[model samples]
Target: MVKLFNSRSSRPFRIILLVIAAIAAVAACAHADTPPAIVIAPSPFAWSVVVALVVVIIALLGVFLGMVNKSLGKSVQIKATVKKTVEDSYARKIRNEYQAKQALLDKKIEQVRQRFTMVMIKVKNLLDTLDHKELFNAISNLIEVDIGASRYVIFLVDPVKHELYPFRWQGYSDSAVEKFSMSVENAHALTYALKRKQTIYRDAATSDIELRKLLDREPLSNMLVAIPLFGKEKNFGVVHIAAFADGHTEIDESEIRFLSTLPTFIGGALANADIFVQTREELTSAKQVTEHEIAEKRRLQEIFSRYTSAELIESLLRNPEKIDLGGVNKTAAIMFTDIVGFTAFSSRMNPKEVVILMNEYLSRMTEVILDYQGEIDKFIGDAIMARFGVLSDLPYPAKNAVEAACAMMEELELLSSDWANRGLQGFNIRVGIATGEVLAGNIGSSRRQEFTVMGTTVNLASRLETLNKELGTRILVDEATFVQLPRGVKHQKRENVRIRGLDTPVTIYEILEQVKSAKIVSIQPKLDQLASRNNQSTDKDALPDTPPVAGIKRPDN
Candidate 1:
């Protein structure tokens, strides 16, 4: 029991021991004065009473200890419950804090995402447009409509002038905008931004006193931002944004960061716009030059047609590059026609009369030559030097030459009659035709050039014209040309003559007139052998009489 009490209830066990020891001493003292048996016999009743009292006292102590144990257990249980409730309250508080932080974090993340997306769309719009004005308008819309800036202006640099020019703006009048424009000498935020090649602002942390002072001079917003546009080469321009629409006093760091990227996009866009404008202008200028060249070529064609055949003019125009100003040898038929005695006739008549007669005669002759697709090589005083197959290939050059020569003679007859009726001295011309290889191209120095044929064939044709005076014929042709004529050509064969510049004598023929049936009535003229005389002596003293027999008057040689 002592071990149990010592182990279970140490303080209560000590109190019980002290009381039990005192009781034992009192019992010993009372029993010492009397005999043991006699004392026991007399105290049976008293013993019962004493036993009951002791039992009552022990029971009361047991009840008190039980109450103490129960009370102590209840106190321990209450402490445990309070501790659990406090822990639960702390856990609830921590959970609430965690949830509130998560909600706040989610809201921040969503706001960042939304802001990022909005900025991306604004940048995309700026990149998509290439026109200078359109790009400015897109920037304006992003600032005033997207970014919510109440007032804004876009400026672009003039590369040549090295000055800033207003590109676009919103919420500013013309006078206000002009006052706000910045240059190297200006005291504005744009100038400072450009100088630093960074952004300038008049806001919470950063303040631009110069810009504020500049704005104070005018009726403009105070809160402003100026970001310089940097290009590959240099700063292209600047953007000025001021006065938030919602009346925000300061710009957010996120907004400033987003606005900083605009210069890169806008600079590249402006460069591309410049390239497009330059390319379009170059194309327009090239188109105009091409049109002008075509017009000039047409004018040249018209002018060339007046000197050569229409077909030759068209051919020249089509292939102007192929036209060799350098000479080329070509097979051609050359015709040389001259007035029979133009020098002597002009001496006899006045200058006006000579001009009138020559104009009329040459006009008729030129018409016939052009109609037959002949190129007039040149005019030698009162003579015409023309070619049939020089610049272009002629299918029937020999035939064209013969026909043109005959037409000229016929027209000359009518002209002679007209001259006679006008009391002017009548005129006659002789024609010489030949066919052979000749050099045909532009000939002369750089200053003056003439497109003509040059060879033995040309000299032979000239000699043949002189031979007409000795032969008493109007039209004479070398044997080379006579044989190429069509079978139905009308011609009278003349004597074989030794033409200058030829090794051997060539047979010649005189074309009279084509018959009504297009058949030739040609006869080798019966003539006595005559001395080869120079044409200069044929009309040295006087001119021929009126019209001779076959529309040509020939003096006796």
Candidate 2:
């Protein structure tokens, strides 16, 4: 048996014999060891108990073996189940973490997209309006409502005036807003932004004392942003925004980035507004200047009308440069006419009556002078000094003067008759005429000047006027004047008289009337005819000696 146990050939048969021997040996031992007492022919209950014990013991043994086998199998199954559960739980945990991360990333992306979209919309809205007030209101609305900034202010820089004034504001009262306005030179933050041409932020650490103080004074956030309104040439101004209105402050990076691009639009709007204001001002100034010039001209016309005839005034106005404050030497006829006994006549009447009479006589004489296109130099007491051909070149100045003198004497008759009807004294006037070179133009101080003749010609005219009283004549002409008279105009020769201030005796003439057949009643007709004839003769080069036509008389002198 030992050999079989050790050998591999009879292993199966030897294992079966060994099992049978061990069982027989156990049965022999059970047979040899007997109990001390035994029950024979036991009762049914006792016998049943014994059998039940056997069954119980067998069942107990079977249960023990089955329990061992089940323990091994359960251990293996529990291990496998535990491993599968652990692997599923770990994988599920990793999946949940990935899902949570993806969800969070999607949420952040949506927020960023929404923020960008909002900023783009706001930027588009900002450019829609061009009105200054509207633009300011729109900008304020975007910052305060859309951009979520609580407080904001817009400052426009006036480069010409060198000032920065608050243009618009939000979240502040009128008085408070007024306080924020300051000069650009004094606003340190604004100045820095403008100088750098960039955006700047002001906080506790910023090195701007005035800005810090200003922030402290207003109901603004501690964190403030200043964005320069950049222009093509320079910065227009600044837009100041505050982070907090009245609560905790938070600054969004996107908001700042968005706002940094808005000043280009604002700058363009401001430039247009400024140009409009300047252009309007210039137009207003130009209108004022034009009105002033018109008023000045009207005033000048009124003043000049009082000194000369309307015709002379028109001529002077046409050539205003000729109305200078100096003298020009020219050949002209100066006539001096006065009441023959004016001193005696005035003494006999009251001052009022004398003025009336003098004005009456002077008015009639002035009418005759103006009718002949002569300038009344001045009215001296009851005497008149007039010049012919000073303002306009007369065809014949001496002839015009002679004709004016004759007309004056003729008109006096009607004037005296009217004065007689009014019971005013009637007087005769002595006239003197001289033709020579005289300084004729405005002459006097800057404050006041008179357009009158000054020279020996004027003096001689005065001397000749006095000779009328001695000669018992109403009209007298010096030799220089008499030679210019047309033969058709009737004049009588007077004796040679040495007038005062005259170095030599002057031949004087007494102008009477015009020859009736000649139809030369006044020098005006003769002058017109003369001008016509000269103009025709000049162009045709055919000078006619007989005054060009039969209707006109020739100057036989």
Candidate 3:
């Protein structure tokens, strides 16, 4: 058992014992306790009491939290029920509104389809023909009506000058009136559209100040739509639709696709029409020129046929310009044909009969010359001077001249039959063919040019025909003509003689029967025979009162 003691009772016993041990304890304590001793702290009962109070407060708080949790759960349940009900009600209302709006939008779409169909019908009316101004007026009117535009302008090209010109202008604002000229080159907007072969639209042209100035105040197109009439490698013009619609009236893809496509067809039609019109005008002018040329050619043919044969006339007609002042040296068989009794025949005949006879003989001989491809140079009275192998193209001129002479002789056979039919005997014709170099060209003064052969060769051919009367043959061909002639031609030895103008005496041959003849004499004796007959014919006319029944003595032969 333990008892509590007071401090006084405990101190005396401690002090009595401390006498012996106190001194020892005091010395050890003093040595150990040099820096001052601190007393150890004791645990407080007040702290435990404070801890108990905090625990009590925490327990109260837990109880209050439990009650608040139960009340808040009830409140939250009520609010959630109300919120869900409100959300479901709002969802139904909004859904109904959306369905009604969708139906209205569908109705609007159907109406737009109907109007677009009508617009298409009207567009077909414009495509009926490829007329520009008419189509543009219709299109601009459509824009002004549909889009509520104030003004419209159309520009087209002047076909004559190919310059851009204005077609029509509608509703002008007075502030900017008078200036409407828009050159295609100067119009960057229009040129760009045309070059691309597409449709271009500007919602606001007035916004571009520089462009507005060029437009010259006459209601600048707030919204300008252009379609290019572009064809296959051809540009006809631009179809411009100008309108004073608000800037918000922008052309969308659908409008561009519709407008630009028709322009392609329109452009092609315009191109076809333009080409046709131009071609028609050209053909008319060409016909006029050709008719005039033909008339001139026919007139020339009539006049020159007397001098040149028909074959030669055709060549001259084809290239009238070939007759130039130039000469060529060619070896030719020059032929001269003269009537043996021309002087006596002329003296016996009247002027009228002489002309008629001369024309008849000339026409017949000219045909013969051409049949042999001989070009007749000219006719000196009843005498004919023709040249064979006088050409630039014929390389074998010497050979050709012989062939022509052979053909000319053959043609003379036809005349015998013609004379029998005409009740008159054919006259003896003297033909002379000489081969030599001669100058053939259009020779004359600058005022006039005559295509004639010149030189001693021509003179020799003329003089040779006169020699035919002495040679005792129908045709006299020089040694030159005989050497060039092919063996196929029928020729016999005529005579040998010294040509008057030449130093050498050349041997000549005669083509007696071009077809088949026994032998025709040179017929120089026929010249005298014809002269005697001509005297009888002249004496009858000169004898004024010769009785019809009286036998007029035949003229002495």
TM-score of each: 0.40, 0.42, 0.37
Top lDDT hit: 1
Q: Which pairs clash in the backbone of model 3?
A: 18-22, 176-217, 176-218, 472-522, 473-522
Candidate 3 ranges with C-alpha deviation above 4 Å = 1-324, 348-350, 395-413, 446-448, 494-496, 514-557
* Candidate structures ordered by lDDT, highest first: 1, 2, 3
lDDT of 3 by residue, 1-557 (tens): 12423443244334434453544454455447472475435546554464456545555665566567668778999999999999999999999999998787667556556656766676667667444345555666655664345665545554334444444556665334336544556645655566667666664445766444443322234436766766786666665555545634566544544455556665655554342222212322333334455455555454455555444555556555544437766667788878888788678767876676667777777776665567778888788888876643343343455455545555555665775687645566787777677887768888976777898768877877888788666677665555444333466664447878887665666655452311222332443354444545533422221112112222221
- CA lDDT, every model vs. true structure: 0.66, 0.64, 0.58
| By TM-score: ranked, best first | 2, 1, 3
How far is 4's C-alpha from truth in model 3 (Å)?
99
Off by over 4 Å in 1: 1-303, 513-557
lDDT of 2 by residue, 349-460 (tens): 9999887777777777888888777888898877889998787766567777877887787788888898888887688778889887888777787897776789988998
Candidate 1 residue-wise lDDT, 69-121, digit = tens: 77997999999999999999999999999999889877766665676677577
- Which is the winner by lDDT between candidate 2 and candidate 3? 2
- lDDT score, residue 443, model 1? 83
Q: Which residue pairs come into collision in candidate 1?
A: none
lDDT, model 1, position 98: 100
Candidate 3 residue 416 Cα shift, in angstroms, is 4.3
